[model samples]
Target: MNTKAFLEPMGSWAWWRSWFLIFFGCAVMGTGFVLFINPYNFVPGGVYGLGIVFHNIFPSVQVGTFGYMFDVPLMIIAMLIFGGQFGTRTVLAALFTPGYMNILTRLVYPDAAAVESLDPALLLGGRLDLSNDLLLTCVIGAVVIGVGQGIVVRQQATTGGTDIVAMLLQKFAGIKFSTGILLADGSVVLSGLVVIGFGIGTAEAEPAGWMLTLYSLITIYITSRVIAYMLDGASYDKLLFIITDKHQELRQFILEDLERSATYLKGKGMYTEAMKDVIFLVVSRREVRLVEQKIRSIDPRAFVVVTDAYDTYGEGFKPLPDADTIQAE
Candidate 1:
């Protein structure tokens, strides 16, 4: 179990780039939690969601600190179950998010009074609190959080906690990943109902109420859509199937210029009974036109079929199962 090699990215440049993206994602997500979501107590899911619940009960403890309380144990569990395949990058994400969240909390709220003032309240006896712009805050905060999470996932890392729970459920219960995520997050959301409550206005105290819960669900939905869009959205990448006579030349172009490999399939034309070489390859949407142009140059009559590839994973693309998984295999 030499985890050193598995924990390290294949090359130095790649290692640094992955870390940069992971940290950047953490910062973005943390900022959203501190400035927008935390102020209003949205409880959007993850360890942070639980943090908000705890914060409501115990205002003295910081949400980010509570996140750490959940994350460290989850990290340990991930290491034990997934081993090196769980990756050091995931551990970094788990730690970076809460750490940065604490940093952002301090920067935004320097004193106890500022933190206490975040709850929904009235100003000057009759006016509503300006900071309680629920709709706009939820939408904007969801977008920010979604994009940040998408970036971290693109690096094949996670911020731990419930994500680990979802993975374990998927592994042992034969549950799909998406389903597992929904179930886990949905449970957290339901818990929020109890923590935040389902009520309207009260003269004595301001409760989170059912309305905030509904708004929280909206934010979660928006965040999921944004994450989906960032991850693979429509037309992000395409699978090209080119049937042409100039197979060798096209293959060479793909290998050399495109720096991508292709698969060649032998086929016979139905009408002419002539042999044909079908080339199957994938290219980013940005590179589709160039690849098409190259194909035209090589063979004017080549029949090309282009289809969307939502997500692609494998060597030369996404990494294979983590090092430990590969070893076990």
Candidate 2:
């Protein structure tokens, strides 16, 4: 198979824009990892999370170095298994993020010796010392990481790490993608429990290790929600099902006034045994009230139900994804 076939050609402006987003996203992700997640050793489940665990054991090695060690092999394996779908953008993001983190770490802790010590006071000159406020730190880190990841994902590229492992598991073991993510991340968190929680690395058992683990779970949940919100906006369209005698009038109102389309489903009333038309329509949240008012005006007794439509792709909505487009998530 020609790998080039999967690569989409872009105009100069779009090409620059895509690369900019990738670079900026990686930097943002690195910021979260180094400043918020790393200093206090909060394992949020990724290569970097594992890096934090390994860093506890090998203080000399930076967290980002472990990220590189894990990411390179994962990228190779993913490319082998999935082919050119693992494009240049993913490779750049995987490789660039760790280097950026290492640079940021050095900048954060100017003293070379302080890097290994993981001193909370030394980090950001004690300004961002959330040692007393772990929950706040977790929330900040998750939001920062989520925004960065969301930006990268918007460009249809991923910062390959455990995500590759999850995809591999899905392919080989028949595990669901989501389940694979849970398994991969769960193992990383569990390792933190053994290494950091039990004090295997520090030789000083941390009583707060379980609390940190719980906080990490909360971080993961918040990050996932933020990423979802970034991908799909906060507001969802409204879907309406209306059954009424004034079908023609409602249809005319929808078409002429609302300038929207609706589908009429032929139905039979269960109790009355009478034929009726069910008006099925999808409208934006703002237009929903207008639709309701119009419906009430037409027939006050019309049986109507309104629900949220999370994803609507059609002529007047989001375009369908291209068949050849590759989404690395």
Q: How many residue pairs clash in each candidate?
A: 0, 0
Deviation of model 2 at 160, angstroms:
1.1
Per-residue lDDT for 1-329 in model 1, tens only?
22574556567888778778989998898887776788776878888988887777777788888999989888888777876645576787888898888776665554665564444341222133436578998888899987888787667667777767766776687664444555677777776777676421212223646676787788787776776666555444789989986778888899999899988888898999998878879888899999999988899899999998766777566554543221100
Stretches of model 1 off by over 4 angstroms after superposition: 1-24, 84-100, 120-133, 150-157, 173-179, 197-208, 225-236, 244-261, 268-275, 294-301, 311-329
Query: Compared with the true structure, what per-residue lDDT tens digits does model 2 show for residues 153-251?
Result: 677667888767756675677774444556788888888888888998676866788888888887777776666666677789999999988878888
Residue range with the least summed lDDT across 10 consecutive positions in model 2: 320-329
Evaluate residue 34 in candidate 1 and report its C-alpha lDDT on the 0 to 100 scale.
75
**Model 1 poorest ten-residue lDDT run:** 320-329
Root-mean-square deviation (CA) per prediction? 5.8, 3.0
TM-score of each: 0.70, 0.89
lDDT for position 325 in model 1: 26
